[model samples]
Target: MATLLLTGASGLVGSRLLPRLVEAGHTCRALVRSEVALPDGTTGVRGDLADPDALRQAVEGVEAVVHLAALFRTTDEDAVWRANLDGTRNLITAVQTYAPRARFFMASTGNVYDAAAAQPGRETDTCSPTAAYPASKLAAEALLADSGLTWSVVRLPFVYGEGDGHLASMPGLVDRFGLHPAHTYSVAHHRDVATVVGMALAGTFDGRVVNLTDDAPVTVYEMAAFAGQPIDGSSEPLVNPWAGRMDSTVLRGFGFRPAVPTMQAAARDGIL
Candidate 1:
């Protein structure tokens, strides 16, 4: 089993993923800014991604790194860039110096795609994100590509499940952002994320950028209804129908299958 260093161990995704990684028989170490309880057998290092010494200690002797930390849903552009881009650079540099041979896996977002795309966002698509969060994540991806490290990036769509309340928050976000009710969005369950990362840990996705999503895309109206916060329906023509959809052909070709294939399946299984 490989020794792994995981950043963002206390966040939504990381908190759920750490236990799975530990259960997979890997020794896990988490880098955190403060005291936080982590999965048993997973060590927590008190440090920030901006600190070189802390990162150096985190990466030392680790065989893999899963980067799940990111700044999302914030108005502070500088904080977003610093945490997403600059912090990624710090971690990459530390890993390069301390554990050059380690495999690196970073969690990215599907929002990096252009909003007016004619088709589902594919790995081969030219991304020109207008939002701060996705733009910062794209910039971070570029930095990792040039770092000369063995790395892979998984672009995640709307992630939900394990009582994260991400799905339940859709109505509020739609109202605040004036989102089109008919606009379809791709989604992935937290368990599916664990599956993809498990494959990455086994070196199945080395040197690749894979988009992770379920079998079907769901509309905002449906999501809002599912969350028990139904919103007004709009019959007006949708401007960005494919805005949140992603093509997961690359991931499928790698023999990846989402355990929770759709949001409905998650609901039926009582996992959402």
Candidate 2:
């Protein structure tokens, strides 16, 4: 099993990923900012991306780096960029310094694409990410391209599972992102995200961008249901005509399938 360094090991996705990696026969060295219990056979290294010496300590002898750390939805957009972009630069530099041969895997977002595109985003489409959230991730993706590491980036859709409760905040998302009533979005379960990360680390997919999503686009009405609210005429027209739809053909080529296929199905089964 590979000894891998996992950043953001305590966040929503990170909390789920650590156990998934452990179950897959991998030993994880997770980076954290405070005292926390390490998973069985997993080590916790106290560090921050701003501290170079700490970064080196965290990655020492790790065969792979799954960099899941990110900053999101802050009031300050600049802080978002620095955390996502500068933090990534710091991590890659440390990897180059010590674990130079280690493979790199990043968790990115499909929101990085232009929402009003002509078609559902594919690996070949260009990115014109609008917000600081996705823009920072795009900058991080660029850093990986220059890092000289074998890297794989999986662009995830709206992730919900394991009591994520992200669906409960749709009112804020609607207002913040200017979401529209007819607007559609894609989604995936947390387990599917962990599965994709595992597959990427195992070299199942690399050297290209892959959008990991479910089989269909979900409507704002469905989101309203998940939020436990009624859909009113408060929404506007979608800015990105193709915002929520994505192409996952390459992901299928890796033999990865989503366990929860849609919000409705997830709700019926109590995953949403």
Q: In order, what lDDT does every prediction score?
A: 0.93, 0.85
lDDT by residue for model 2 (174-236), tens: 778667877878888887898889888888886767999987777776787777885675445
True lDDT of residue 241, candidate 2: 66
- Tell me the spans in candidate 1 whose CA falls farther than 4 Å from its real position: none
For 75-181, candidate 1 gives per-residue lDDT tens digits of 99999999999999999999999999999999999999998899999999999887889999999999998889999999999999988888899999997999989
Off by over 4 Å in 2: 233-239
What would the TM-score be for candidate 1 when compared with the true structure? 0.98
Sequence-dependent TM-score of model 2: 0.93
Model 1 RMSD in angstroms: 0.9
Clash pairs detected, candidate 1: none
Number of the top lDDT candidate: 1
Candidate with maximal TM-score: 1
- Residue-pair clashes per candidate, as listed? 0, 3
What does the lDDT come to for candidate 1? 0.93
